[model samples]
Target: MSGALARLLGRAALHAGWIVVVLAAAILGGVCIGETAIPPATVLQTLANRLFGAGYPLDRIDAGIVWNYRLTRAIVAACCGAGLAVAGVILQALLRNALADPYLLGISAGASTGAVLVTVAGVGAGAISLSSGAFAGALAAFLLVALLARASGGGTGARGTGQIVLAGIAGSQLFNALTAFIITRSASAEQARGIMFWLLGNLSGARWDSVLSAVPVALAVTLVCLWHARALDAFTFGADSATALGVPVRRVQALLILCASLATAVMVSIVGSIGFVGLVVPHAARFIVGVRHVRLVPAAALMGAIFLIAADVISRIAVQGQVLPIGVVTALVGAPVFALILLRARPAR
Candidate 1:
């Protein structure tokens, strides 16, 4: 027993250390590898000068590029990645399905619809504006899904797995259709193009205010998730088993789902609906750290940060001067990985 525990600890430590290093490297890479290509030392000095009074003066343009653009973008990417991954973890546990994710739950579709409507209607414009619309849409979707699931499962939050999945699928299709209808009928071609980019997820316009807000919120949500890790682990054995172990199966399900939806909505509001980070990262983290949510949640968050920041970096550099949408890159990567996971877990006929 002691030997097994030691080995597990060692592996957890190694994974945690690597995640930290990767995050640091990613931050440096983000700051230094842009069009300007600032050196790492210069990036550090500029940041130090801003934070501390260590008077190392940099070219104003270089400082602005590092501080105003790349750093902000990287922070936002990390926040989005971490938030989405944890949301996936919570959702997969709540729904008792490995394949569950925010995008799968119709939350992303609802958020996208709301944000698109806000933009199209010219409701608000600025760093902090569209989030309200996105949150509203996400909440609406959550309620719809819950209602549909409950109705299908005899009007209770303790919905059967099949009912919840079906509800999510139906709700997602409905919201997505509504979004398409609104865009096609109400938007100009240019507006439609911009809206499509947002739907596909791009972080090129990320700013410091967004970073400041998103990072803290994402971290807070992750902490909340971690607090419920034991309950989540209980959930893996099915609700009946969990209930036997004194878990409040229904209440826990509702709480975690709501929290996950809120986190997903917040991320989508900032960077548009970047898919698969939530779906793919948690599963990958589970592979590395096992099914225990205590280890899985933090690992997933760190891996998520690394994955999205790396993706953002690739999106920035893949096209000479033009940035590709991050959702496109993630989809290309996630689709094949997801297929592989499903294949590996394919049940015996």
Candidate 2:
């Protein structure tokens, strides 16, 4: 027993070390590869100076861009990716649908509408911040979807799942239409252009403030999901089966779904509606780590973080002297994968 326990501890430590190394490498890559092309050695020097006071003399401008701009953006991107991917895993587990994701509940659409209201419709009369408006809109959309689901007799069953999905679709459409209407009626060309860019997922505005807001939410959501990992595993066999296995079906579902909603809301509010990280990364993680939630959750989070950082890097370099929307890059990659997954999942004739 002692030898087995030691082996387990050693293995766990190894995995943790690997995760840290991979995450650090991805972050450094994100910081180093940009239009300005900061060298990796300088990037390390800047980090050593700021983090440890190593007194490495680096270019002031390079240090400022690395410490203040790229590092913050990379960290926020990682947080958004991890949070969204975890939310996707939770939703997919609860709903027993491979297609379920963070945005399946209309959270993203609602956030967009809220942002448009603040920026275009003047809903808050210039008092409310964009992120605040987006968060409120997300919550409102979720509440409306919940009400609609309940009205349609949704619960923990196949029929319930269908009803909830339909309700989400309805809610998303309603919010999306409202956003389009507001943009068409109220926004000037410049405001319209800016809103469109943001709606398509721009990480250019990410700063330390964004990192401060995102990191806690991502960590909290990941921890909560990990704590309830067993519940999620049971949920894979349906709520009825989970209940039979001594899981408090209703309480677990409510708690986890709420976690996913809040996490999604916070991320969308911070980064706009970047899709596919949630939908694609969870599936990829599941493929790599199998179905156990304990392994799946952390794997998903790690992969999601690295994936988003890479996508952001691609977005920065994809166009000559211009950045593509992060969403476009993700979509361009994810849509084809999504189609392949769907095709493979189709029942054999």
Candidate 3:
């Protein structure tokens, strides 16, 4: 017993340290490693000068690049990664599937559909924002899947994974098709090209406003998930077992799902559907911290932030002069890892 406790404490300490390391790495990658590569001392001096009015030597263009573009992209990437990973953690628990993610579950697709409508069709021009439209669409998609699963007698009983997966597949396809149709009909050739880039997860537009809008919601929802860690653990043993333990299974499930979906929609609205952070990060965190949500959630959040920030850096530098879509980078990295995971999951014959 004492040995197990010691191991757990050690893992907890590692998780805490990992958070600091990743956060520092994010800053370094954002400020010192991008195009025109600023020096660490210069980056620190620039920040110090801004905060403390200290005279630090730096060129205006370099300072502008770091402060206005790279740093903002880094911050937004971190928020996006953390938010999506938390959503992944919740959906995996909610649906009882290791592979469940916002994009896989169609939530991101729904958000994309809504954003495309706002941008292309001008659905709510002058009145509604893209973020609001995406949030509504995300909720709609989740509700549609839940209702379909429930109708098919899936969410509450028997190998519910099949039902949720099937429902999600159907809903995702429908929304994605709708998004494509909207783009085709409403967008001009140039507008269609821009929309396609956005849908593929462009972070070139990352700014302070996007970070301000996303981080608070991401932080709040992630904390709420961590607080409910025990309840989520109850879910691992199935709904019947959870009920026997006095957990209001349906209510808690609904609340967490809504929170996760909302965060996902907001992030997707801003960044345009970066996939696999949610799916991949939690699993990686689980390998390090086990399945306890308290440690798992924060670890996954930090790991995700690191993953996306690193990916953003790579996206910018991969092709000499042009930046690639973040979604493309993550998909390239995640697909093989995910496949290997599945191959390992194949039961011994």
Candidate 4:
């Protein structure tokens, strides 16, 4: 038994190592192919100056582009993708449902609703901007679902996962309608543009301050999720069985929903709604490695980073000189890739 345990651990570690290497390569590849491909030597120098503050003398505009523009955007994209994917794995595990993702559960929609509301209604400025509003929106959605879940005739039964999903669907439709309404009612051109950009989702607006704002939320939420991996593993066999094995089922369920909400809200707030990374990356990670939550969570996060980074790079080059919204590129790439995967997985149909 000890030897078998060792073997399993060894296998998971190997997959994790490979995934890390692949993700690093993809990030570097993305840096290479974007709008202004800095010469490798200059790229190194620019990066060194930005990170270590010790590169050769650099031009002001070039330095600004490297330090102020590209690196932050790339990091934010990677962070957003990773957080969503981690949240995806948690949802999938909790519900014992393969199709579960953080956005699919309507958290992203709720966050988007909040951002649009702020843009339309005109909210606070500076530090109290979009991300806070989006977080509040996500919290609202989670509370609504929680309330509905416990109501009589709702999904409070043994498998409350279905109830949660139905609530998410309802939330998505309602918020989407609200978003369109705000867009239609917009008096100012900038308001409409803000709404549209939030829906389309991109990291082009990533600021160092905003990126810093997101990092701790993302990191704290991820740690909370990581701590609960064992509970998630127990969930695979169903809630009752997990409880039978002394897992605190209700507490874990609430924690998963809460932490995932925080992560999703912050991600959507900062980067808009880059879809399919959350949905696709976890499944890809699960396909390559096994579904053990320990490896699965980090693997999904890493793969998601790579997925978004690569997709954003493609968006840059997909059209000559025009930077398409990363969200659009993700859907365009994700839909066909996911379809092919599903087709391949189907039983020789």
Candidate 5:
């Protein structure tokens, strides 16, 4: 037993170390490869100076841009990616649907509606922050969906799964229509453009405050999911099977779904509704790590962080002078990849 434990610890450490190296490299690239083009060495030196007081005589402007703008944006991007991906994994597992994602519960659409209410409709009279409004909207949407599911005869079986998905669709459409109506009636052209950009995911405004909000939510959600990893694995075979295996089906579902919703709400509130990370990353992680929840969870998070950072970088450099909406870039890539996954999933005729 002692020898087995030692080997397991060693293997775990190796995996952790590898993940750190890869994530660090991705963050560094995100910091260095921008419109201003700071070198990798300068990026490292700036980090050393700010984080450790190494003080390697760097230009003030460059350091400010690296430390303030790019680094913060990269970290927030990572948090968004990880949170969304883990949420996706949880939903796909609990719902037992390959197509399930963070937004499947109408959270993103609700968040967009809430943000529009704050920014375009002036619902708060300038008192509430956009993020706060978005979060509120997400919670409202989820509550409505949950109630709708219950009315539709919620169960822990296939029937329950279908009901939840349908309810989510209805909730999403309602909130989306509300958003459109508000924008059409209340927003001027300029305000509409800005709101639209944010709705499609703009990380340009990411800063230290965004980082502080995002990091904690991401960590908390990930830890909660990991804590319930065994329960999640039991869920893969359906709620009845999980219950038979001594798992509290309804309780686990409620807890993990709430965790997914909270994580999704916080991320959407911070960076707007960036899609496909929650959808595509889990599928990719499943391909790489198989179906085990323990390995699949962290793999999805790591791949998600790298994938979104890369997408963000592409969004910045895709056009000569203009940054494309990160959502557009994600859709452009994710749609085709998902299509291929669907084709592969089809059995031989």
Candidate 6:
């Protein structure tokens, strides 16, 4: 037992270290390859002078390109990727459905709906332009789903899984209708364009302040979820069993739901609706470390960060000079992989 435990820790540490190295290298390489395509040697020279105020001289253009624009965007993508992936992991665990995803509960649709209403209705004004509209939308959808399940008699039983999924599908469609109505009723093409782009997701507008706001919430949620990884494992065994083992199943579920939705909501608000990171990252993590939450969650987060950074790099260069929407590239990559998973996952014996 002692030897086995030691080996597990050693493997976890090794994977975590590799994730860090991959993320760091990707960010550095991406920054150098942005619009100007600065030579790596010049990038190093410019980076040194800009950060430490020392090495070789660099013009303001390169400084703004590296520090102000590209670097900030890459960093934000990494954070968003990790946050969404953790949310996906939590949701999959909570539902005990390999196909369950953060978006399935209607969070994405509701968020997009809220963002659309605000953008269209032009309501409210404040220091913060986005007033948890997306988060409120997400929470509302969550409650709605919970209500749907309860109304359908989905309480603590083996018979409820179908009803739960059915309710989720209904809720998703309802929110989708709401989003479409707002966009369709618009008088001008500009509003339609805005709504369309927002729904599709993009990382072009990543600001330092957005990163500051999102990173803490993301990190906190990830830590909270990690601490509860063991409880999550217990959840896989069913609620009654988990409770019998002294896990506060209800409390843990609520806390995890809030943590995940909050992390995902805030991420959606900032980056719109980048998909696949949350879903694919978790699937990839599952392959890497099986279903152990402690092994799966952190590694999933890292994989997400790396995946999104790499995706963003592709988006940057996909169209030569014009920048493509990062979300488009992610979906293009992610959707097919998801399909493959569904096709290849073995049927229960």
- Count clashes in each candidate, considering only residues at least 3 apart in sequence or on different chains: 0, 0, 0, 0, 0, 0
Tens-place lDDT per residue, model 4, 43-111, is: 668878767888588787766776677767777777788888888888788777666676666778888
**Cα lDDT, all candidates:** 0.84, 0.87, 0.86, 0.76, 0.88, 0.78
- The lDDT leader among the candidates is 5
Clashing pairs in 4: none
Q: What clash count does candidate 6 reach?
A: 0
- Kindly list the per-residue Cα lDDT of model 3 for residues 213-253, writing each as its tens digit: 98898889888998889888888778788899999988999
The TM-score values for the models, in the order shown, are 0.88, 0.91, 0.92, 0.86, 0.93, 0.88
Model 3 spans with C-alpha error above 4 angstroms: 1-18, 155-158
What overall lDDT, based on C-alpha atoms, would model 3 receive against the true structure?
Answer: 0.86
The parts of candidate 1 lying over 4 Å away from their true place are 1-21, 122-129, 153-159, 347-349
Tens-place lDDT per residue, model 2, 17-98, is 9988998999999999998799999999998998899999878999999999999999999998898899899988988878
Clashing pairs in 5: none
**Candidate 5 wrongly placed segments (more than 4 Å):** 119-132, 149-159
- Best by TM-score, which number? 5
- What digit string (tens of lDDT, one per residue) describes model 1 on residues 1-349? 9999999989968976986787888788877886557899888988898899688978888888888888899889998999999999988887787767889889998988888778776556544367777877888987898789888763323447667778888998998998898899889999889888878898878897788779887888888888889899888777777899998877888778777877887788889988899999998998888999988999899889888988888888888979899999999889999898888778989
Local accuracy of candidate 5 as per-residue lDDT tens digits, 104-159: 67878888888888878889899998778877887788889879999989876677
Residue 36 lDDT, candidate 5, scale 0-100: 78
Give candidate 3's error at residue 7 in angstroms.
16
Q: In model 1, what is the error at residue 175, expressed in angstroms?
A: 1.3
Runs of candidate 2 exceeding 4 Å displacement? 1-10, 118-132, 150-157, 346-349
